[model samples]
Target: MVVLSRRIRSEDWKPVGVSELEVNALQVVRSVDNRSVIAGPGAGKTELLAQRAAYLLQTGASPAPRRILAISFKRDAATNLAARVRQRCHRIHAERFDSMTFDAFAKGLIDRFGQALPERWRPRSDYEIMFPGDRDYREFLSRQIGVPPAHIGTYADIQAISVKTFERRHLVGTPLPLDGWLQPTPAQWAAGCYWQRFLHEGKKSFLSFSMIGRLAELLLRVNPMVQDALRLTYSHLFMDEFQDTTPIQYELVRTIFLGANTVTTAVGDNKQQIMRWAMAMDDPFSAFDGDFGATRTPLYNNYRSSPELVRIQHILAQALDVQAVAPVSKTVGTIAGASCAIWDFSTPGVEAAHLAAFVAAEIKAQALSPRDFVLLVRQKASEYATVLEPAFVAAGIPMRNEAGMVGAIMLQDLLVEAVSKLIVNVLRLAMATRAGRHWTTCQEALTALVGIAHDDEIAQAKFANELDAYVVTLKATYPNSPKSKVASRAIVEDILRFVGREKVVAAHPAYGQGGWLDEVLDSVAGHLLASSCNHTEWSSALDVYEGIHAVPLMTIHKSKGLEYHSVIFVGLDDGAWWSFANDQIEATAGFFVAFTRAKQRVVFTYCSHRGARTNIATLYQLLTNAGVKKVKIA
Candidate 1:
């Protein structure tokens, strides 16, 4: 018997759920040497990191009393990684694993060590965070740079979204342009003034996520004691999605963990580096290796797609990364039809109607859940919704645009998902004659949502009882038979009152519980009003929807790190991917990511009359070579 750790034997271990890529990578999981792992989509990067944490914690490899910090780029990714570690190890061991976004990690440092920063850079305790756009910077500059109100044009009227960053030199207090204070140009002057005013927001500093990263870096460099404390607290570190790491974020890691005798692992695929517009590093692997003296490893197995689909991926992968080899598929080809196909239409409305009718008819014939299919668009899911919504509505299929905004919150916000899913399932479970399997899953989700460890018997028991008591209250309050239909919007309000909106707000500080959360709650409840379904039909729209009965329509970027039974790509013409010619590699990479998000079959829909087909010429050639069938509907 091969012993992985103290209590984990070979047969007892599995990577992620339903992903049995085996424990073959156990050596890397248990390795002490710092490494940068590059793997394609569905290669099980999350599983590898989770298993590594499990191995280190279970075996005391991290030298006990010390913890492991894993930083991810997204909230869901971080929470999912933490949940996996909890599921794989004992409660005591699992509690040592800490996973959070890079922003959250940096924000925490500022919250704790702002007083240690130089007086000029220290933020007030009540500083508010804002996500500013480029327009905000331009508008702020228009006012401070002596641009006349008449000449300021549209910028004069622009409302600032945040305190924006200016040119690198001016923001750091360097006005080395051809001119002085206002600099060579008004823009440079605005940049310098913006930096000066960043800390002077009426006695309350305004900080952005990037600003937080910069401050965190400054704090560590000036105060080595803080670094020493962090090193003492966490002996091992993992950076997930390293390819998307920016220069300052990388520097933040280098200052604290480099040569501090900490084992650091960075895992990501350079090909999937999609945040270039936000200034993702040009070469993260090389940069990380240069700093950490780390070795490189790549996992070349595709566990999420069928063999035919893998071949289609190879067609696009070669165009994106010539040096990288294609991943062999672990999924067998079982779909009776062609693994890939394309549908051509003369107009967007025709295409949308055909797609909705096709999917709805297929569900009726095949007896499959609507959730089995996912719709992917290049960007702005709402643009496609105008045509898609009515078509789907006529077809009687429940589909929600996952990328749309609700007031100030994106529909995918963690707090929104937690609250929305909780209410939907709670209502369903309440009216049922018997408790279903969903209740157990829902309970676990509630536990994780409130930051409870999976193995904490006392806390779990207490929460479970509280949940039962809450349900009892709900039963008495809304007592009805199973057939009694309820309003989805009302359910949202009910959960808010039952849990006390304040408590929900206090639980997730990431999104806040104040006016912002209230706006989100109100907008979410209003959004549900878009659905005409009384109750049963509305369940699909409001549920967390991990399983059957809901079709998730989102952008290709949001669809990463996920898979579905089938995939539908809408708007595959030049207009949707307008910048394809400028950055063909990244464009191809986006298309690659989209196609790889399928388990059995994938479909693409393009409207010839909608836009020019020249941009996606390579994709067309690749699909044809992979034997993907094409059909036109006029």
Candidate 2:
């Protein structure tokens, strides 16, 4: 009887092997009156989200407006989902849906409201990049917690600590020092105070990306005009990875298009609520249909992985407070004749070497290329000493990172950051006009000009003297450096090249491909600084990765949305996943996310020798229950 039902039952509606879950979602979404979508893991939530978006797009009036807004928690996921939506819809009436990450969308909103803010916080015509200040926030906190800097387990730990600390101290304007290396000046502290008050009471505050959802909610309630504008802009909103959304995000969703925009659909698994630190509250899966009162739908089919992989995931899900129930228990395809075994080398160099060897074996034995496999680690820092660096070098495999982009035109970011500093410093120095260019050599001049009354007088003077000597060396030996001109450009180039080759290892690719992207970015950067201009371009590390031809060794979190022929989940220990942080209950969601990434073979490696009672044992029990055969625990 409803207009939505009329659209759903149209003759053009042909099922494309949608699981019962998807069908249920389509039916329920049509009658959306604020109900919860309660489903288990591997329930085709993402599929449903895509389908819901496609259905809305296809059935809508011809020549789709950019009314449908879909958002993802991560940039990659957003891109992937958008691709899927574009593919599913018919071209004759293709949907022009707008997509972006929540942070990016929030940044757009902030830019729109920039003029209303204080003068200091006014929007800049140029890029306003989020810069990391002097001291690494996590390193500082590690000292306060009495945890050794080396003892910091993962980047996730660092990020969590940083986010929490930033919220407590910087965002909230609470000036309590954590560990004393990086102290905010009086002015900085005052800025923090102002921001805190602004967030608490001010209608429009300078919000960090983490706090965007909260701000969006505030605007919805406080600014009806913005809400109406949003309604006109986005007739319907479909949020993917709903489980990861924080409480304030949910409130914002409700506040904006509550009555006029009733066609709201959210997709997520209750078992995958992993971002508790960012204030992501209860699982939005059930709340989508229940608390928010949208129609409920269940999607239980597992399409991404083989049955064996699904079984492994289902087994792991048992450890969670909220577990997903598998609809049809099917095993994944066999990685036949492929040698799969798990081994551990405690030391870093040896571990890297071992990983490289394993990758080599996979390439030789299974006919897999380096790009076919990915080596994922917990942190970017881990890639160098522990895994990919040594392994790749030992096996003669090339690798890429920020440094790999060297001399490449793609990496403008690194170039901009590095060259800007150099030019600023050069301008202060006021070096000779090679091309009548003004240079600033502040560090050199300031060292001789002043002295800290309470500090080491002799040593300070000596340091200043040494700095002057270094400047003289630059002027005489490398005049074409940052301080000099076109003639000096050669010297600058040589210094950058030498520094990169010797100390930084070509922070990017050189003239050829797979060298380092950093080089290209820096080269473009220097040119931009000299030219004084801006442009928008983008690139990725796909070349270095594909060329290396190695197996991926990475963390479960990093492994999200990535699949491989064979996935070996290392470090399935309880302590690693449970962590000291309070997000243990939600963290189990990662196990499902990781296990499902394996397309064929799912090999889980556990360190049973290290601990008395291992979480892997529990995982084993779950796997067996889910009908995973040939699962050996070693």
Q: Give Cα-based local distance difference scores for all models.
A: 0.72, 0.49
Candidate 2 local lDDT, 1-634, one digit each (tens): 0112233444465433343445566664444344456555445555565666666655662124546787777665676676565556543222346667666565555545434433433333222233233253344334423322333244344334443445534442322232312454433343334344434433333344544444445445545787788877776677777778765566567677677644666766667666765557665665556655566566666666666556556556667753446555433565664223344434445545565676678677877765666543333424343445655766866443322232433231332333333433433243343412222234322332233222466765665565556555655653332322343345445434422433232221122122233444356444433332221110111122123333445555545655666665555445454552345465556656666666666554444443322534555456556655443322
**TM of each candidate vs. truth:** 0.84, 0.61
lDDT of 1 by residue, 1-634 (tens): 1223355454454443334444435657867899898888778888789888877776667767899999987777787788778776665676678888898888878877877777667777667787777677666655544543444334433333134435332343231222224323334445545644776658677877777787788889888999999999998999998888877788888889988888999998888877766657789899888888898877888888898888888777777778878788887886677778898998888988899998897787767788889999998789887778788878888677878776566666633255665665676665455657557766765776676776688999998888888777776765532221234446567777765665665555544511445565565565555433344433443343332456779998887777888899998889898888877777787888899889888999988766978867887888887788888888
Off by over 4 Å in 1: 1-24, 147-192, 364-367, 414-433, 436-464, 479-508, 511-516, 523-533, 536-548, 625-629
